[model samples]
Target: MKPSPTFEERWKRLTSRARMSIPDDFPELPPAFHTRVLAHWQAQPVESWEDLLATLGGRAVWAVVAVCAIAAGFVFTDFHEARISRPELEHVITLEAWIP
Candidate 1:
Protein backbone atom coordinates (compact mmCIF):
# COMPACT_ATOMS: atom_id res chain seq x y z
CA MET A 1 0.00 0.00 0.00
CA LYS A 2 1.21 3.59 -0.80
CA PRO A 3 1.88 5.90 2.14
CA SER A 4 -0.58 8.85 2.62
CA PRO A 5 0.55 12.22 1.23
CA THR A 6 2.01 14.77 3.73
CA PHE A 7 -0.15 17.90 4.62
CA GLU A 8 2.24 20.19 2.63
CA GLU A 9 2.00 17.96 -0.45
CA ARG A 10 -1.85 17.79 -0.21
CA TRP A 11 -2.09 21.57 0.30
CA LYS A 12 0.19 22.24 -2.71
CA ARG A 13 -1.89 19.88 -4.92
CA LEU A 14 -5.20 21.52 -3.80
CA THR A 15 -3.88 25.10 -4.38
CA SER A 16 -2.43 24.13 -7.83
CA ARG A 17 -5.87 22.70 -8.90
CA ALA A 18 -7.73 25.77 -7.48
CA ARG A 19 -5.53 28.30 -9.44
CA MET A 20 -7.59 30.18 -12.14
CA SER A 21 -6.32 32.24 -15.10
CA ILE A 22 -8.48 35.06 -16.64
CA PRO A 23 -9.16 34.75 -20.42
CA ASP A 24 -7.58 37.41 -22.68
CA ASP A 25 -10.83 38.26 -24.59
CA PHE A 26 -13.22 39.44 -21.81
CA PRO A 27 -16.70 40.73 -22.94
CA GLU A 28 -17.47 44.43 -22.11
CA LEU A 29 -20.91 46.12 -21.50
CA PRO A 30 -21.81 48.92 -24.00
CA PRO A 31 -22.15 52.57 -22.82
CA ALA A 32 -25.70 52.84 -24.20
CA PHE A 33 -26.80 49.81 -22.11
CA HIS A 34 -25.43 51.47 -18.92
CA THR A 35 -27.24 54.77 -19.76
CA ARG A 36 -30.54 52.91 -20.42
CA VAL A 37 -30.26 51.00 -17.09
CA LEU A 38 -29.53 54.24 -15.15
CA ALA A 39 -32.50 56.02 -16.82
CA HIS A 40 -34.84 53.07 -15.97
CA TRP A 41 -33.77 53.16 -12.30
CA GLN A 42 -34.23 57.00 -12.14
CA ALA A 43 -37.74 56.71 -13.75
CA GLN A 44 -38.95 54.38 -10.93
CA PRO A 45 -40.65 56.26 -8.05
CA VAL A 46 -39.23 55.94 -4.47
CA GLU A 47 -41.72 54.23 -2.15
CA SER A 48 -42.49 55.64 1.36
CA TRP A 49 -43.65 53.88 4.61
CA GLU A 50 -47.31 54.74 3.76
CA ASP A 51 -46.95 53.12 0.33
CA LEU A 52 -45.45 49.97 1.95
CA LEU A 53 -48.29 49.78 4.55
CA ALA A 54 -50.89 50.30 1.79
CA THR A 55 -49.32 47.40 -0.15
CA LEU A 56 -49.60 45.22 3.03
CA GLY A 57 -53.37 46.18 3.35
CA GLY A 58 -55.41 47.39 6.40
CA ARG A 59 -56.38 43.95 7.77
CA ALA A 60 -52.79 42.65 7.73
CA VAL A 61 -51.53 45.79 9.55
CA TRP A 62 -54.30 45.47 12.23
CA ALA A 63 -53.56 41.77 12.72
CA VAL A 64 -49.84 42.55 13.20
CA VAL A 65 -50.71 45.33 15.70
CA ALA A 66 -53.10 43.02 17.62
CA VAL A 67 -50.45 40.28 17.79
CA CYS A 68 -47.83 42.74 19.10
CA ALA A 69 -50.30 44.07 21.73
CA ILE A 70 -51.12 40.51 22.88
CA ALA A 71 -47.39 39.65 23.08
CA ALA A 72 -46.75 42.86 25.10
CA GLY A 73 -49.71 42.05 27.43
CA PHE A 74 -48.29 38.58 28.09
CA VAL A 75 -44.78 40.01 28.73
CA PHE A 76 -45.89 42.96 30.99
CA THR A 77 -48.81 41.45 32.96
CA ASP A 78 -48.14 39.98 36.44
CA PHE A 79 -49.30 36.39 36.94
CA HIS A 80 -51.16 35.83 40.23
CA GLU A 81 -51.39 32.49 42.08
CA ALA A 82 -54.81 30.98 42.80
CA ARG A 83 -55.77 30.55 46.50
CA ILE A 84 -55.21 26.95 47.78
CA SER A 85 -57.92 25.20 49.78
CA ARG A 86 -57.24 24.14 53.43
CA PRO A 87 -57.28 20.40 52.49
CA GLU A 88 -54.86 20.96 49.58
CA LEU A 89 -52.47 22.95 51.83
CA GLU A 90 -52.68 20.19 54.51
CA HIS A 91 -51.89 17.51 51.88
CA VAL A 92 -48.80 19.46 50.71
CA ILE A 93 -47.70 20.00 54.31
CA THR A 94 -48.08 16.25 55.05
CA LEU A 95 -45.99 15.37 51.93
CA GLU A 96 -43.27 17.85 53.02
CA ALA A 97 -43.34 16.40 56.60
CA TRP A 98 -42.74 12.87 55.18
CA ILE A 99 -39.54 14.06 53.31
CA PRO A 100 -37.78 14.81 56.68
Candidate 2:
Protein backbone atom coordinates (compact mmCIF):
# COMPACT_ATOMS: atom_id res chain seq x y z
CA MET A 1 0.00 0.00 0.00
CA LYS A 2 1.24 3.55 -0.79
CA PRO A 3 1.72 6.09 2.05
CA SER A 4 -0.42 9.22 2.01
CA PRO A 5 1.29 12.43 0.85
CA THR A 6 2.61 14.88 3.49
CA PHE A 7 0.86 18.29 3.87
CA GLU A 8 3.67 20.18 2.08
CA GLU A 9 3.64 17.76 -0.90
CA ARG A 10 -0.17 17.80 -1.15
CA TRP A 11 -0.27 21.63 -0.86
CA LYS A 12 2.37 22.03 -3.59
CA ARG A 13 0.53 19.71 -5.95
CA LEU A 14 -2.85 21.31 -5.18
CA THR A 15 -1.52 24.83 -5.72
CA SER A 16 0.39 23.92 -8.89
CA ARG A 17 -2.70 22.38 -10.45
CA ALA A 18 -5.08 25.10 -9.18
CA ARG A 19 -3.19 27.98 -10.81
CA MET A 20 -4.75 29.73 -13.83
CA SER A 21 -4.84 27.34 -16.80
CA ILE A 22 -6.56 30.20 -18.63
CA PRO A 23 -6.08 33.38 -16.58
CA ASP A 24 -9.32 34.97 -15.29
CA ASP A 25 -9.54 37.88 -12.82
CA PHE A 26 -9.82 35.76 -9.65
CA PRO A 27 -8.29 32.46 -8.54
CA GLU A 28 -8.60 30.70 -5.17
CA LEU A 29 -5.56 30.93 -2.85
CA PRO A 30 -4.03 28.43 -0.44
CA PRO A 31 -5.50 28.73 3.11
CA ALA A 32 -2.24 30.21 4.48
CA PHE A 33 -2.05 32.87 1.73
CA HIS A 34 -5.79 33.72 2.06
CA THR A 35 -5.46 35.13 5.59
CA ARG A 36 -2.46 37.33 4.66
CA VAL A 37 -4.12 38.76 1.53
CA LEU A 38 -7.43 39.35 3.38
CA ALA A 39 -5.62 41.06 6.23
CA HIS A 40 -3.80 43.40 3.80
CA TRP A 41 -7.04 44.29 2.03
CA GLN A 42 -8.95 44.87 5.31
CA ALA A 43 -6.23 46.91 7.06
CA GLN A 44 -7.04 50.47 8.13
CA PRO A 45 -5.14 53.25 9.94
CA VAL A 46 -5.38 53.01 13.72
CA GLU A 47 -6.49 55.84 16.02
CA SER A 48 -3.91 57.45 18.33
CA TRP A 49 -4.39 57.48 22.13
CA GLU A 50 -4.95 61.26 22.13
CA ASP A 51 -7.65 60.97 19.47
CA LEU A 52 -9.38 58.23 21.47
CA LEU A 53 -9.14 60.25 24.69
CA ALA A 54 -10.49 63.34 22.95
CA THR A 55 -13.49 61.41 21.64
CA LEU A 56 -14.23 60.07 25.10
CA GLY A 57 -13.76 63.52 26.66
CA GLY A 58 -16.25 65.12 24.24
CA ARG A 59 -19.13 63.09 25.72
CA ALA A 60 -20.15 65.11 28.80
CA VAL A 61 -23.00 62.71 29.57
CA TRP A 62 -20.56 59.81 30.09
CA ALA A 63 -18.47 61.86 32.53
CA VAL A 64 -21.59 62.76 34.53
CA VAL A 65 -22.90 59.20 34.30
CA ALA A 66 -19.59 57.76 35.49
CA VAL A 67 -19.46 60.12 38.49
CA CYS A 68 -23.10 59.44 39.41
CA ALA A 69 -22.61 55.70 39.05
CA ILE A 70 -19.57 55.80 41.32
CA ALA A 71 -21.45 57.96 43.82
CA ALA A 72 -24.49 55.63 43.75
CA GLY A 73 -22.31 52.54 44.24
CA PHE A 74 -20.58 54.12 47.23
CA VAL A 75 -23.83 55.35 48.77
CA PHE A 76 -26.00 52.23 48.39
CA THR A 77 -23.71 49.25 49.08
CA ASP A 78 -21.79 50.40 52.17
CA PHE A 79 -22.96 49.19 55.61
CA HIS A 80 -23.33 52.20 57.96
CA GLU A 81 -23.40 49.89 60.97
CA ALA A 82 -22.57 46.24 61.58
CA ARG A 83 -25.50 43.92 60.83
CA ILE A 84 -24.43 41.52 63.59
CA SER A 85 -25.42 42.14 67.24
CA ARG A 86 -23.90 40.61 70.39
CA PRO A 87 -24.00 41.25 74.13
CA GLU A 88 -22.00 44.23 75.56
CA LEU A 89 -21.05 42.13 78.66
CA GLU A 90 -18.75 39.91 76.55
CA HIS A 91 -16.42 42.90 75.92
CA VAL A 92 -18.60 43.26 72.87
CA ILE A 93 -17.19 44.08 69.46
CA THR A 94 -17.03 47.89 69.15
CA LEU A 95 -18.09 50.16 66.26
CA GLU A 96 -14.39 50.64 65.35
CA ALA A 97 -14.87 48.06 62.62
CA TRP A 98 -17.32 50.47 60.94
CA ILE A 99 -14.85 53.41 60.93
CA PRO A 100 -13.05 52.42 57.75
Instruction: Single out the weakest 10-residue window by summed lDDT for candidate 1.
Output: 74-83
- Give Cα distance to truth, residue 45, candidate 1, Å: 5.9
List TM-score per model, in order: 0.37, 0.32
Error of 1 at 47 (Å): 5.1
- Among the numbered candidates, top lDDT falls to 1
- Per-residue lDDT tens digits for candidate 1, residues 1-100, read 9999999999999888777544467679899989999998899968888998798888898999999999888766634535578999999999999977
lDDT of each: 0.85, 0.77
TM-score of 1: 0.37
Candidate 2, 1-100: lDDT as tens digits? 9999999999999889888475786866779898887787679557789988888876967889999999988777765645554566333445555444
Residue 12 in candidate 1 has what lDDT? 91
